[model samples]
Target: MDNGKIKHIGVFTSGGDSPGMNAALYGTVKVAEQHGIRVSGILKGYEGMIDGHFIPLESQQLQKTVHRGGTVLKTARSERFMAVDGRQLAFKSLQDNDIDAVVAIGGDGTFKGLIAFSEISKIPFIGIPGTIDNDLAGTDFTLGFDSAINTAIESIDKIKDTAESHNRVFIVEVMGRDSGYIAIHSGLGVGADAILIPESGEDFLQLLKKVKDYRSEDGFIVVVSEGDELGAELVASKIKELNPEVDLRITKLGHVQRGGNPSAFDRMLGIRLGAASVNALMNGERNVMAGILDNQLKFTPFDSVVKQHQLNEELYGLLKTLNT
Candidate 1:
């Protein structure tokens, strides 16, 4: 697609909300303006795309949004977008608005939606990784991973103080369904006695063994990913059943992990990827995700982006070594 031909661009955040999504909008609106391209902010993702919820954006209005927790345009999952009829409506909306191209801020499901829709439509789409899971393949860091782990770490640290005072074993559950990045990073950051993630393939016995070594510590914290085979409840039950004298408690850090100001790294990453998405479109790139690998911008075609990024075995090893 020629930049001259691409006069209007539509941008939206889909699925889960992340800390840096607003900053991403800032970058897109600002950069697209420089290229003489009009940006239409689509509300509520694919839902808005089908309903024709288009709003013109200006850089000046987005100045203070860089540090915001959630997205300015908002985000949501659309069951309708999964159907052929729903996508047709979305396509008609774009055509009606004369949108030349689009940028999507979201994770696996979002990109997959673009690919599926493309089979029946002609509009080009470029994506920016925005999920907290950090599970997208190719990107070294998704938009909110840093802020999420930082949030998890801060919450875990405070929980430690309480656990230490009561001489209790606290089993904390964090998000990242089927992925361990959040649990691993937060657990390691807070010096958790044990970290249980789905990738570890570790059973409760193995986890108990790790905790045994640090049992005498003032506060015992075990970070378990929601995806872990033995979740916080099971772990708590097993531990309490095995040792009746041990005081144990369970805490599920739910949506709290998904909210907060974008961390320094996340702010930079979000804005950088956002700007890169517009640049990619201007350079005639589409059906790909704007990502950072080795601290440099890279694009992975939707066909190449996998469901899950491989956890760095080396980082996992480091997590184990450092905790010991």
Candidate 2:
């Protein structure tokens, strides 16, 4: 439970892969190696841990990966790990490999699994926020969020060119299973005519009327989050129904937003948080997440990180005001 007692650490990326995961891995490995602590890469997350798929890692192994996209250790969802027996197997693997602690990188589900595993194992764990959804609490901005919003905005910018050329209405759908961060930011960035987010109750008729009222020679652009009740397709259909003369198109960004190299902002955030996780573990911290709040490093309890995050009303209101 102390720095001297910790000689080896296991690191893994769980749940969905994010753009800044590699940077996080690199930072962890580099910091651990600097302290003469051996590092093991747990491939495919808890599933790999239970399967004993530990790979040796050092500072050199992570060279040139800070700018890379996705995770070098890969990631997967393990339903089996939710059970006690699966956690025993993972604990056995950690014990057999002499891993003294763990650094888990991912969203809420990853942290929840780590917490469950800790209930049955003696090994300590630290979490890093690395989801595109930006739904995780404790952190003002999760890793890959900036990259994802930039990616979505770039795609929207291109779609706007075509929408304007064709003189038609274009509805772009972005990813956000339960959050509207992506849609709101991208919509504001692209100066969308209207944005439909799950956080804001849908008003299809009102949206259609807004489009009709905003119609101009430059064409119309609407952004919709995937979590919205009326997705891009449904919203586009309703708009077309309300105004038959208006030409309309739909584009779903899909997983494309999850791809791409880590931006400078994301890379730095990953490195800072990753190193902070190692420091937390070395200082005898456990069951905590290292995050950045207001540009300062802070550690938060896992329970708070998993709690549901409310939508940012001020930002949402700003979007409406800007469009109006």
User: Listing every candidate in turn, what is its Cα RMSD in Å to the true structure after a full C-alpha superposition?
Assistant: 1.9, 1.8
Off by over 4 Å in 2: 202-206, 213-215
lDDT of all predictions: 0.88, 0.87
Kindly list the per-residue Cα lDDT of model 2 for residues 192-262, writing each as its tens digit: 87878887774344476687655578978888899998777778777777777888888899999999998
TM-score per prediction, in order, is 0.96, 0.96
Separate clash counts for every candidate: 0, 0
1-324 per-residue lDDT for model 1 (tens digits): 236768999999998999999989999989988888999999999999999999999988986899899999988899999999999999999999999899999988999999998899878899999999999987899999999999999999999999999888999999988789999899889988778888876445566665554456487888889988878898888777666667788999999999989999999898899899998888888788999999989999887775655778887787566545
Model 2, residue 46: displacement in angstroms? 1.4
Worst 10 residues of 1 by lDDT: 208-217
